[model samples]
Target: MIKKITIVAGISVVLLATACKTKDLKMNAAQKETVSNKKEVVYQVFTRLFGNKNTSNKPWGTFEENGVGKFNDFTDTALQEIKDLGVTYIWYTGVPHHALIRDYTAIGISNDDPDVVKGRAGSPYAVKDYYNVNPDLAVNPANRLQEFEALIARTHQAGLKVIIDIVPNHIARKYEGKNNPKNVTDFGANDDVTVEYKRDNNFYYIPNKHFEVPDTEKALNGEENPLIDGKFEEYPAKWTGNGSRLAKPDRNDWYETVKVNYGIRPDGSKDFPELPAGFDTKSYKEHFDFWKGKDVPDSWKKFKDIALYWTDKGVDGFRYDMAEMVPYEFWSYMNSAIKVKNPNAFLLAEVYNPNEYRNYIRLGKMDYLYDKVETYDKLKDVIRGKSLPDGLSDIQNGMADIEHHMLHFLDNHDEQRLASPEFAGTPEKGKPLMVVSTTISTSPTMIYFGQEVGEAGNENAGFGTHSRTSIFDYVGVPNHQRWMNGGKFDGGQLSQSEKDLRDFYKRLLNFSLKSAALMGKYQEIQTVNRHETQGYDSGIYAFLRWSDTEKLLVVTNFSWLTTSNFEIKIPSYIMQKWNLKDGNYTLTDQLYHKSAIQLQVLNGVGKAHITIAPSESFIYQL
Candidate 1:
C-alpha cells in the first residue's frame, strides 16, 4: 500500500529561510507574475439582517424606518456600518430566489417540513433561478435589474466591492418548470435527443439508470460504441444527458454534476427540435454559437455569460457554492471572464478541505476557501491541551501553504460555534481560545455576525417570532422587543456582555486591518517547547511573523492556571539581526496597550523567562 507522508517544520527555521532566501522564494514563479495583484478584505453579510426591507423595519430596518423610504435605501446604513468596520468588500448571501414554488414553507413562512424548513430562511444553496432575483428580496419587483445595479454602484461608492453567491451545481426543482417531473424532463423522458444522445453520433448515454461512474467515463472518453452490464465491464464510459443535463432534480445522488458534459452540435445543424419540453433548442443553438467550438454542454456555457454580465454590472466577484462539485474548467473559464470585466474581482470558493486539493490555486479557480481541517482539528486539539504530535507546528505549516488567501474563522453558519464546549472545551475557555486562533492565524479572518456578540444557541435560528439564536442583538435591537415583536427596532441596543465583546471585536478588527505584517505573507520567527520554563511545558506555544519591514512575535499559554518561571530560547539569528546589545528586546502588547521588554540573559545565551496567566496570549513587536 502507498502511504502519504507530510513534513512539518518549526517556526525558527522557517523565519531563517525567509531572512536568508527572501528573493529566491518570495512566491512561486507563476504566483510572482501576479504579485502586483492587490489583496482585498471581504466582509460577508447576511443580507436579511443588513438590509432586506421585506424582512424587518426598525432603525436598522429594511430600507424604511417609521414609513420613511429612500432610493437604494437598504444599503445606505449597512454600507456605512461595514465601511466603519474597515471591510473592503461586501459578500451578500442569498440575493437570488430561494425557491421557485413560492410556498411559504420554503422561505420559513410556515414550519411544516423540518428537512425543508424549520422556521428559518431556507439555505440559499437551493437556488431557484440563475438569472432572476428573489421577488420578496427586491425593493422593486419590476425594476429588479436596475435596483441590483444600483446596489452594486452604492457598494462601489462606499469604497467597497460586492460579491454575490452563485450556485451552479443545481437549480431548484420547481424552477425547471411545473410540468417537469423530478427525474424525467418535460418531454416525459429521462434524456433529450441531442447529437450526444443519438447512438449514431458517437456520444454516450445511459439507459434508465441514474448517473453512475461507467456512464460518466463513456461520455468523457468519447467511446465509439460502448455497452455496459451491471457487473464489471472491460471498458467504461462517461455520461452526458442530452438537453436534460441541467434539469436533473436530485443533486446529491447525481454524478453528472461532478463532471458535466461539454458537447457541441455538429456542422451547421439548424431546427433541432428533439429537446426537452419548454427548453428552447433554438435559443441554446444561438447561445452555443457564441462559444463556437467549446466542448462543454450548452447549459454549462451559459455560466460564462452570466458571470460576465454580473461583473460588468459592478458586482466585484463570486463565492462559488459547492465549488468542488463543478469542474475546474468551469471555474477557470468563469474566472477569466470575470477578470476581463473587473480585474480586481475576488473569487472565493466554498471548499471545505482545501489542503487536499491545493492544485486548484494554480488554475485560477479560487482566491480563498474555508480551511476546515486546521480550524476544527488542529486548533481544537491545542485548546484542549491534547498531546499533538508536532504541537503547533502543523498550524505553522498550514499557514505557510495558503498561497493566495485563506479565510480564518472559529465558526460559520454551517457549523457549530467554537463557543460550544463539545468542540473547544467550554464557552469561558472557548471565547478566549477563539479570539487567539482567529487573530493570530496568518490568513484574512472572517467573523460571523453573531460570533463576537456571544449568541450561544447553535440550533437553527427561526425566521419568525420564536428564534432561539437571534441576530437581533448583533443588529442592535433590545432583547425584549427583538424577540417579542420579532426584530422590530434597531437603534444599536445590545446587552452589556454583547456590547463588551462587540467593542473588543471592533478594536481587534481595526488593529488587524491596520497591520500589514498580519495581512501580508508571514515568516515564522521561532517556536518553543515547555521544558524551558517552570511548569511551562504543559500546554503553551510561541511563534513569530516577520517581513522585511515589520516583525511580530506571539506567545500563547493554553492552560487554566498561571504559568510560573517559564524560560524560552531566543533564536540567535533574530537576536543578532535585530541588534539586541543587552540580549533583550522591547515587547509591545497587541491586545492591551502595554509595553515591557526587560529580561535577564542566562550565560549570554539570550534566553528569557516569564510568567503567563491562564488562557493568556501576548504579542511582541520589534
Candidate 2:
C-alpha cells in the first residue's frame, strides 16, 4: 500500500518510480507560503515487537520461542522517557484483532489456517475482528481491550496523544465479529450472496466460485508445513485484498485478506455521491453538513460508524492504510463524521496519488499524508550517493504550499532501515536527513522505535524478509534489545556507538520542539552558497529559519567520505531581511552551543567559514 504522490496541475497523480528518481516536485504559486506553528513528532512502535526480548532468532517459532510485547510494556516510566525525546504522539501499530495462527479459539477467538495466512503469526493487516484488540498483547489474553484502554490513558497522562491503524480498505479472509456491539451486524451478515455487487453488501462475491489457496510450493512456509491438516474452508471466493479477481492467487498477491467493497460497481462507476467540482476547497464542517441528511450507501455508514466508535472510546486518531484504494467520497463521508465528533483528531493517510492530494485533504478531510515519494525518497537517493545535492529545495519549493500537511519520516514499518545493507548502511547518514526534515518545514516527523539505535532488521523470520523488521513473525530487535536493557527501559546495555546515536536524536528533536524560528519561516541558502561562496561543495547544504525574536542558519553535510570546510556566504537579500549591520558577530551551533562560527558582514552581506564532519548537521543561531 506504499504510494508516491506527485503534484501536477494542482492535481495529485500516481507517480510510480522503480528507482529513487521521482518526478520533479511542483506546486501552485498560491500554495507556497512559509509556515509558523508548533512542531509535532510521532513515535511509531510495532506493538507486538516493541518489548519482545527473545534472542533465539528461530524462524516460524512459537510465541514463546519469540516473545511478544505486552501493552503494559509501555509503562509510565517508558512513556515519560519517550515523551522526553520530544514526541507529541505515539502510533501503536498492530493493536486490532487479526488472524494470527495462535489458538485463541478456546477463549472465543478462532485460529487461522496457515494455508491462507502469510506467516506463522499471520499479518496484522489480516484483521479478524474490528471491535477487539490483539489478544497476544495482553498478559491475561482475555483482558486485551482493558490493557489497551489503560495504555491510552497512560499515554494521555504523559502528554502524548495515541494513534492506531484503521485498515478500512480490507479485512481478513475469515471475517467475523464475535464481540460486535449489540444491534450491529457482522460483515456479509445481511447481504444477498447471489449478487456480485450490492450497495449494502460488505464484500464482493464470486457467486459460483469456490476459494482455492495459493500453491504451497511457492509460498514461504515453516520448517514443516503448518497446514498439513489441510482444511481451510471458504465458500464463493471473494476478491483478494489487492483486487485480484482470480480464485487462486499467486504467493506474491495479498491473498491473506479480502478487499472491502465501497459501493463501486464492477464497471468502475461509483454508487455513492460524488463531491462537487469545487468541493476541493470546502471545509470539513461543510463536508460534514452535506452528508448529515443524505442517505448514503451501506458500506459508507459501516466504516463511518467504526471510526466514530473509536473516537467515542477516546482514541485520538487513526493512520489509514491504502487510503486511495478506497474511493475519495467514502473518506469524505467517514472522516467528516470523525471531525464532527473530534475536530482535533489526527487523520493521516497513505494516499500516493499526487493528483489526489488536495482532494483528499480538502474534500476527503485528511489532516496529513505521507511525503515519502518526495522528501523521503530524495533523502534516500542523496544518502545512497545516487543523487546530486542540487538539493531538496526544488522538492520543498514544490511542496511548500502544502508542506505542513506532508508527513515526513526516514523509517517506518514498510521501509528499509537506515543501516540495512539494501539501503544506506550507516546510522550516521540519518543525522543530516533528520536535521533537514525536522527543521525545513512545519510537516510532522515520525521515527520507528529502533531507528535511533540503528536496528538493521536482518532477521530471517518466517514470512517477512530482511531489510525491514518482521511484523508478521515474532522476533527480537537486537540493537533495540540493548537499549531496552531487559524492561528497565534504560540504555544501560547500549554500546558507545548506539548511545551516541540516541543522544544525537534526543538533542535534535528536543531543539525542534523548542525552537521558535523553525515554525516561523524557511528560506533556502544552499543554492546561493554553491554559487557565491568559495569552497562550497555540491554535497553541502544550508538554509535559514527565523521569526521576529529568533534567526538561525542551518548547515548539513551529506558527504559520504569527505569532511567539509567552506566559506558560506549569506546573500545581501537575506542579510537585508535579517537587518544585518557591517560588523562581526558570533553564530553558535544549537546542538553544541559553545562551538562558535564568526560571521563577517559588510554592506548587508555576510560570510562565515566553518568545518563540518561527514554526515554531520548544525543549527547556527544568529
Candidate 3:
C-alpha cells in the first residue's frame, strides 16, 4: 500500500496509520486539483480595429465608409487572425462611447466629438457616457445585440475568451447633464451629483449666504457661498455665524487626478456648526444615482454591466484601470456580478506592487495584479547584469511568491513598452533576454499589442500619441485602419524591424504554450549546494521547477564578461528517478540544443562540472 499524508498549511501530517491507503488517496486528490488549475495564456488588443479613420479612407471616415463595424467583418477575419496565435484569452481595451463636445484645435472643427479624428478624439479612455457605445463602434444601432452575439460566437469559435477594460475612477468633465456644474443643488444632499464624490467622515459644505465674492473669482477658486443664520451670505469669509474657516487638503503632486472630499474639509477640520439631528444619510446615494436607469442605482452599476456586456459580447475578462483607487466595495460588487455572469471570467487588475497591498485579494475581488516589485524591478536587474542584493535566494523567493497568486506583466499601456532598449537592451541583444525572462518567470505572461514587434516609445514621461510606434503600421495597414501615423493621419505600413520582432514573438508564444512545465503548477526541487551555487553572496542564479510528472533545471550565468565553471550535484530523488549514476547530471543548452555534461573531481568530491558562456542560460530536463 502507498503511504498517504494530508498536507495543509504547507505541513504534511502523517496519521500514524500502519496502512498507507489514506496518504495515497489524499496525494491523488491534491494532484488532481493541481492539474485542474493550470494557468492560461491571454492576448491583449486595442479595439480601434473595429472602426475606421476618416483621413486615410476619406469621405467614409464614419462607420458607413468602412464595412468593419458589422460583426461579419470582424468575426470572419480578425477572429481568425487572433485564434491562429493560440492565445486562450483576449483583452479588448475600451469599446464604449468616448464622444465629447470639445472643440478640435487641430482641425478647427467644433461639434460633438466624432469617433473618427486625426489625433482629434484620442483614446477610448476619454469616455463621455457610461451607458452607450460609440456610434462608430456599433454601425446599425438596432444590430447592437446581434453584433455582440456574433462577436462572442466567433471568439468562442476561435477557442479564446474575451475581456474588456472598465474605468470607474472618473467620468469625462464635458458631460452637461443634471450632474453638470450649472445645476447647483443642495451640497451633498442628493447622491446623484454628476461629479465624483466621497463619503468619508470629514466632509463639510459652506452655505451660500456666508460670504461675498465675484462670480469670476468664485469660478477660478473652488469656493462656495457661506451660510449665515440659515441664510445665504454675500461673502463667505465675512460670515458672522458660529462657523469655522473652510480648509482644503493639500493635494499630492504625483497624481494628475483631482481629489474627492472624503467627507472632510481640506484643512483636516470637522463640521463646526452641526446640522439638525436625524439628517438622512441615505441622501448620499442620490449623487451616484444620477443618469441611472430604473433598475440601476448609479453609473458604476451601468459601467459594471457594460463590462459584462462586453464579456457577453464575446470578450473573456477585464483589465480594470486604476483598480486600487476605486472603492473596494465597488470591486466586490463587480466581482460578484461577474461570477454570476461567467464563472470562468478572468480579471486582471492594473495594480502596481500588490505585495505591498495584500488586501486586494480579499474574497471575490481582483484575481490578478501586476507584480511590479518582483517581476519588473528585481528580475529586470538580474537579466540586465546588475548584482542582486539577496542574490539567487531572492530569485527563488520571488518565484515562490509569484506561484502563490496571479501576476500579469512587466510592460503595459501606462508604462514604456518593453521593446525599448532601456528595458530590453537594443532589439538584437534584448529580444533573447526578453524571451528568457518572460518565459521563465512563474506567472502567466502578458505582452502588449506592439511588444511582439520590437516597438519602442516612452509614454511614461509625457510622450503622446505622436511619439509611440504603431503595430498596425508593421502588419501593413489593414483596409480598415484605426491608427494615426506621422502627419497626424492613418495608414502607415510596418517597418522591416517590426516584422522580425513579430515573428520572434510568434515563436516564443508558441513555445510557451507547448511547455507543460511553464503552464502547470511548479514545485521547487533542491539541487546540491543550492545555497552555495545559488549563493546570496554570488551573483549566479539557478532554480528548478518540476511538475508532478517532469522536472526542469534552470541556471543563468549572470556575468556579462566572465565565463565560469560551476560544479553541481543532482538531488538523490531526481538522480534515482532519472536512472542517473552516482547522483550526477549534466546541464544542456536548450537554446542551442547541446549537451553540456563533463565529470570532474572538485575538493575530492565527484561533481558535474559545466562551463557557462558569458551572460548565458541553460535548462536541463530529466
Candidate 4:
C-alpha cells in the first residue's frame, strides 16, 4: 500500500513551534481568558461535489453520467484530514432536498420541469423539502435522511461541528414534501390563495392570474429535456423569490423559487410587530420571551419549527441565505428560538448592507455576518491595484463594535476563485490578503474547500459558466480532485505550488486558531508607517495585534511585481502599553519562520527595517 500524504506533513514544524511559543508567553488573567476563547475556522464544502472522484465533467450532464457523490463519500479518514487543517466547523452545504430535474417516481418524488430549474442538478437555494436530505446524495433514495444522520454522527466523532443551509426567503416553485413528518405540514397547505397577502398565509399570491414559466429556449439554456414546455400549473401566480410580481418572471430573477411571505404586504408595509426600544441590548432568552403570546406570522413559526427540528437532529448551526431580503423582526423571533434550543449554535447570515450590520447582529441575534462589501471588496481592489491597502483601516475601525460578528473569506460558492484569470490570475496573490484577513480582528475566518488547493472554478458547466464553482450543476472541481487523490484524502497529485499554498494555509489557520492576540486588541499602523517610513506606501499594509502576553506585528505587501523595503515602527502609546525601553527585540514570523528580525526601541519608539517579497506577509511574534 502506498503511503498517504496528509496536509500536515509539510507544516508540522511550524505548528509545533507555535504550540511551544504559546506556552512560553506570560499570560495575565484576561489574556488567559482570551486564549480559552478559541477562534472559529469554518471549512465550507459543497456536500454534493466534495467527494466526487469523477473527472468526466460533461456540460449539462446527468447524475449517472457525471457520477454524483454520496453521503458515504465523507469517510472518517476524509473528515480527519479536514480536521487536521484547523477547521472547527464543516459547513455541509446543499444537504437539504432541493428541486432537481432527475426522475425519482419509483420512490414518490415528482419530476421537476427544466424550465423551473437552473440546471439538471438545480440550485441548492430552491429547496423542495425541508424535512429530508437530498436523495441524490444517498445510495438508497428512500433512506436519504438516515444517510445524512450518519454523516452528522460521523462528523461529531471526528471532533468537528456541522452547519447546513436554511434559506428563509423562498422555496422551490414545485415543492413536494413527501417526507414531511405527520405533525409537520407542507408550506402553503392551508393558505387562502385568493388573497394577495394574509398574516397567516405562507406565501404572497397574485390572485386571478395563473403561473407562467419563462421563455422555453432561454430557460433550458440549449439543453434538451422532455419537460421543457414553458408551462407550470397554478391557479394563481405567486410572487417570485426576488419579490418580482410578474406572472412570468424574467430570466435573471430567482424564477425557480417563490417568495415566502413573512407578514409583509406588497406595499412595503410590515404587518409583523416591531421589536421595542432597547431590545437590541437584550439577551436571546429575553428576546425569546418578548415574542411569547404575540400573534407572529405563520411563516415565522414554520421556519422556527424547521430550525428546531434540525437542532434536534444534531445540526450545530445554519447559514441563512439572502438574509437581508428577509425582515429583521422575523429573524429576531426565529433566531431567538434557535438560541433557546442550542445556545452554542453557529448562526451566520449573508447581510451585505453596511447600515444593517448592527441591526442584524444585535436585533436579529446573529452570531456572524458576511464582511463582503467592506473587507472583501476592498481587499480584492488592493490586490488588483485599484484601491490602497490603507482604506481597510477605516472599514475595520468603523465596524469595531461588531467586528467579531463579521466573517471573512476570499472565496465562497458565490464569489470568483482567487486563482481565476478574471480575479488575481494566480493563487500566489492570495498570500498577503489571507494573512491580513485572517489576523485582522476577532472575526471568524471562512475558507471554501478548494481554496487551499488553488482551485480555479472556470469550467463551463452548463448553466453556471462563470469563474465561480457551479452550485447549479453536476460538475467536478479539477484542482480539488487532485488533492482528493482517489479518496485517499491526501495531496499525492498536488503540484509544488499547490502544496506550498496548502501548507501556508495550514500554518496560518492553526496559529490563528490558538493565538490570544487575534481575539484581543487591534490597532492599524498603516497610516502612521506611510508618513514615517521611506519605502512604505499605499501598496503596503500594516497592523498591530496584542494581548497581555503576546504581541503580533502583521504586514503584507499587495504589490504584485516588486519587492517592498520599508521601515515599520511601533508607536509610542503601544510601546508604553508593552513597557519597552531602548533595546533590541527579536520578532519571528509565525507563518514562515524564515529568520528572526530585530526591532530596535529608542526614545520610547520601536522601529524595524523590513524587506518583503511581492505578495508576501508575515505575522511577527514578539
Candidate 5:
C-alpha cells in the first residue's frame, strides 16, 4: 500500500495563539489521586468535519457549497491544546479514501458513480482505497497520505495516541488497493468468480447472474448520474455487504459495498481451523504463536498484513467496524497478529451480541467492545423517565467479571445527540448521564467533539438524517462551530449556559483521568438502599468507589422536573467492608465544589444527608 510518512512544518499558528479556552482551566477542591493505573479517556472527532469553517448548511450541497476539514486544521498548537483537555487518545474518524461522488480524474483517480455512493462526500466505512487517505481532507489531494502521517506525528508530540477505523466485513464494491506492496495482491485479483463459494476466493459470487441497480436509485428515476447506465456489469453477481444474495439488492441495504469472504461456506460452515475446546482460556501470546506457521486463507492473510502495515506506520490501534459480522476465527488470527507487533495497542470493536461477549473478548483477543445493548440502552430508558433502574445495577453486577473490557459513551457518530428531540431534548439531561457513564466503571470513556457543547444533530445533510451527526454529507455543525470560534479553538461565541455545561464536563472528565477510586473498586449502594429504606427513589442512584488511596461517593438525579433531597444510608455490610469506625468526616462534591456534606461513620454505618438538584450529579472525594 502507499506508505508515505511526512512531518509538516511552519504552519501558521496565529489563530491558536489567540485562543484562550485552556488558559483558566484549573480544577481544584478534589485531592490529586495517585495510583498505579488511572482511567483512560477518549476524544472522538470526525476528522473531515471537526475543522470545517463553512456555514452553508444546504442539504445535498456540492463540495464548493460546504467545506470539509483539512489535515492542516489540526496544527501542532491545536493538538497541544486538545491534549490539555485530559484526553489520552483521539479517534480520527473518516480517515481513509472512500467512494465519494466527487471526481478526481485529473489526479489519475477514477470517478465513482453517484448512483451507488451515499452522499456528496460519501460514507467513510465504504472504503475505496485501504492504503490512501481521503482526498477531501488534504490541501493537495495528490499528497493526502503525507498529510495524514503528519497528523499522526503531531498527535504523538502532543502526548496523545491515535486510532483509525478498520472495516473488515466489507469494502466498496469498486475495490482497489493503490500502491500495494510487491508481496501483496489486490482483493479479488485472481478469485474464481464462477463458483458460489471457494476456500481461497476473496468474495462470494452467484453463478451466471448480472448485478442490477436498485430501483430506488435517483439515476434510475432520471435524476442523473453521469457514469451510471442503470447497470453494474458482473457476470456472476457478488453478494451485498449486508449478506443479501439477490441480483438487485434493496435500496436500504448496504448496497454500496460487497461482503468479503473468510472461509465460510454458503451453508455457514467454517472452512478454516477452529480453536481447541479450552482455547478460550488461553492467553493472547499462546494464540499468537498458534498461527505462526499455519497456512491460512488468502483473506485472513490480506487483512492481517494490512493491519500490521498501518501499525508499522505509527498508528496506535484500530476501531473495528461491525466486528461481529466477520468470522470469530478471523478475529483471533488478525487480533493476535496485531498484538504481536505492538502489545500495548488498543483494539476496540462494535459487537452487540451479549451471548458472544466472552468469546469476542477472550478468543478474539479484542481489548474493548461497545456496551450499547446493556449499558447505553438501559440508561436511555431512565432518561426518558420510563422505567425504574431495573437493568442499571444488573449491567454493572452482571458484567462484573468483564467490566473492564467495556467502553462507555453517551454520544457517538452513529447515535442520536443529547440535545436532539428524538433523543433527550435538553443538554441538561446529559449531565447526570455523563457522571454515571464515566464513574460507574473502570473502563475508558469517550465523548464526541460537539457533545460537551450540546450539538444537536438536526441538520439536513443529504443521505444522513434523524438524530446523529451526518457522516456522509459535508455540513457545518452550528454548536461545534461556536467552540471552533473562527479557527481559534476557543468558546468565544458560546452562551454562559453553554460555558457552564462545558465546565461541568471538563471537571467530570478531568477528575476521571486522575481518580484512583474510579479505577479501583465499585459497589452499587443503591441496591442495598432500595431494600433498606425509603429515602432513595427510582429517580436517584448511588454508588461507592474506593481504593487504599481514595474513597468516593457518587449520586445523580435522573429526573429533570424534580429535586431529590434525602439521606443515603450506607449499609452495615458496606461499613464493615470499608473498615468504618464511629467517626465524622467531610465529603466534598468534586464536580462543582458547591456543597460539603457531613459524612457520619456512627454505629458502624455510614450516612450522608445529601441534596441533588434536577439533572445534577456529584462525585464526592473523601
Candidate 6:
C-alpha cells in the first residue's frame, strides 16, 4: 500500500508515520514596514542575450554564427541607460555555468553531449556548475569568473543592485564544478551507489538499474548533430528532476537534470530533523541559530554554502527557481544563512501553490514571490478578452494579508510576449494592463528587457517555437536588438510606435517609483461605481490609494475600441478615510497630464465626471 502525507490546516505537515511538523508564520511589523517603503522596480534581462547585437537569427545556429553577448557588453553607459528606466535592481538571468553543446575541452571543461542538452545554448535552469559563470558569456572562457565580477562592480557603480538565478531543485545530468572551493565538493560524489535511500545520501539510487536516455526518434527534430547517439553512461540511474523514479524519464520530463535529495525518502517521509513549533514567527537570526549544531541533510548544507558563496561575491539578491519543489525546512535553512550574510538581500522565489505562500514567506524567510497564478494570470485573461475584470477584486482582497510580499509583472522569459499574436496582438493593449498591475498594490514590479519596446518574440529558434523568446537556442531577439541599436544602447532603430510605447513605460515606471500613495492604503471602488453609476461596467475598473498627504484615484478601461464616459462614484467610506469635505476639487490625470476634470463632493460622497479612452488608464490626484 502507498502511504500518503497530509498537511493539517493551522498546524503542521503529517509526514506519514513521522512526528514532523511545519508551523505557520505571520508577517511581523518590521517586515511589513520594509515592504511598504519605495516600490522597488526589478528589470529582468537575459544576461547572455541582453547586449548581443547580432541579427543573424538562424535556426539551430552555432555560437560562432549567432554570436553571444559578453559580460563586458554591459558597459557603464548601457547600465546607466537601464537605471534611468527607474529600475532599482537588475535581474541578470543565466549567469551560472550550465550545460551547453559548445566545446571547452582545451580548458579542462568537458563538452556536454547534445543529446542531453536542450539546444546549442542549454536551458539556464539546467545549471551544471553553481560555483562558476557560463563560459559562453565571457570573451575569454578561462576568465569567465573575473568577467562576471567586473560586471557586478560596474552594475554597482551604475547605482543598481544585482539579482541572479539560483535553481536549487535540481542540477544538470552531468555535474562538473571545476571552480568550486577546495573545501566544498561536488554533489553525490561521496554517496553509496547501491542504496535506494539513505539519510546522508546526496541522491536516491535505483540499486542495479542502469540509466537510458529517452527513446524519442525526433529527439533532435531533424537537426544534424554528431553527439546524438541516443545513449548516456550512468551506472545506477537516480531520480529525474521532475521526480520520475524510473530508470528512463520521458522526453517531456526534465531529462537533462537530476533531482537532489534533501533527506526526504522515496516514501515521502522526511529523514532529517523538523523545525520546532513557532519557528515561523522567529527572525532569520533566530532561525540561523536554531540550526547551529543540528544534523541536517547534505543537500541543504551544500545549497546554503552556494548561496553564501555568491552573497560574499557581492550579489545583492537571488531569484530561486521552482522553490515549491523543495521542502519548506530547507529554505528556512538556506535563506536564513543568506540573511545573516546580507540582511537586505532581495530574496525572490517562484512558488505557484497558493496554499504554500505563507509557508514560503513567513516560514521559509523568502522576501518576495511571483504573483503569477493570481494577479498575472487573471490580468492576462482580461487582456486577452477571455474574462471580465470583476474577478481581479477577489484576488487582491484574498491576498490582503500578504499583498506586499507578492511581486507583480506583465511579462517575463517564461511567459509569451505581450505584443505577440498569441497574446494581446499589439503592444498598445498592455498599457492599461500594466497600469493596473503596477499601481494595484505595494508589491514590487518587474519587467522583461524587451517588454518596454514591444518584442513580439515570434522567432523559430531551433528547439523553441514562436510566441516566447528562446532560452535554449542560440538566437538573437530581433525587436530587442532594435533597442540595442548595435551596442549604442539607444533606441536608434525603433519605429515611431515602438518609441511611443517605450516612452509610456518610462513615464509610468518613474511615476510609480516616486509615488508614496502606491505603498500606502488601497481600497477597491470598482464594485461601488458599477452599481451606483450609469456607465460603469465589468470592463472598467477603479480603485483608490491614499497616504497621509497624497490621494490617488486610479481607473482603467479594459475594452478595446470602446470609450467609457461615466461619473465614477467614490464611496462615502473612502471619502471619510481621505477626510474630504463636501466641496469641489480639481482632479488631474497624472499620466500624460493632458486633462483636468471636476471632482464634486456632495453629502460626503465624491463623484468624478471622466472620459477614459479605449484601453486607457488614469491616475488622478486630488
- If scored against the real structure, what TM-score would every candidate get? 0.68, 0.92, 0.61, 0.94, 0.92, 0.94
Over 516-547, each residue of candidate 5 has an lDDT whose tens digit, in order, gives 66776677877777777565666677776766
Which consecutive 10 residues in model 6 have the weakest lDDT in total?
Answer: 9-18
Instruction: For candidate 1, write residues 181-240 as lDDT tens digits.
Output: 233222112334332343122223444444323222222123121222222211122232
Better of 1 and 2 by TM-score: 2
Q: Which candidate, 2 or 4, has the higher TM-score?
A: 4
Q: What C-alpha lDDT values do all the predictions have?
A: 0.46, 0.78, 0.42, 0.82, 0.78, 0.82
lDDT tens digits by residue: candidate 6, 42-159: 9999988887887888888878787788899899988998999888999999999999988899988998877778877999999999999999999998999999999999999999
Look at candidate 6 and give me any clashing residue pairs. Answer: none
Poorly placed runs, candidate 1 (over 4 Å): 1-26, 32-40, 51-75, 100-120, 176-294, 353-356, 384-391, 398-403, 425-442, 458-491, 519-527, 560-565, 595-611, 614-618
* Model 5 stretches astray by more than 4 angstroms: 1-37, 217-223
Q: List the residue pairs that clash in candidate 5.
A: 1-180, 1-181
Instruction: Report the Cα lDDT for candidate 1.
Output: 0.46
RMSD of each: 12.2, 6.9, 13.0, 6.4, 9.8, 8.5
Show how many residue pairs clash in every candidate, following the order shown: 17, 7, 41, 0, 2, 0
lDDT of 3 by residue, 203-302 (tens): 1233333322221211102222121121222221221111222322112111111122323334444322222232212121221232223232243344
Give the winner by TM-score: 1 or 3.
1
Q: Could you give the candidate ranking by lDDT, starting with the highest?
A: 4, 6, 5, 2, 1, 3
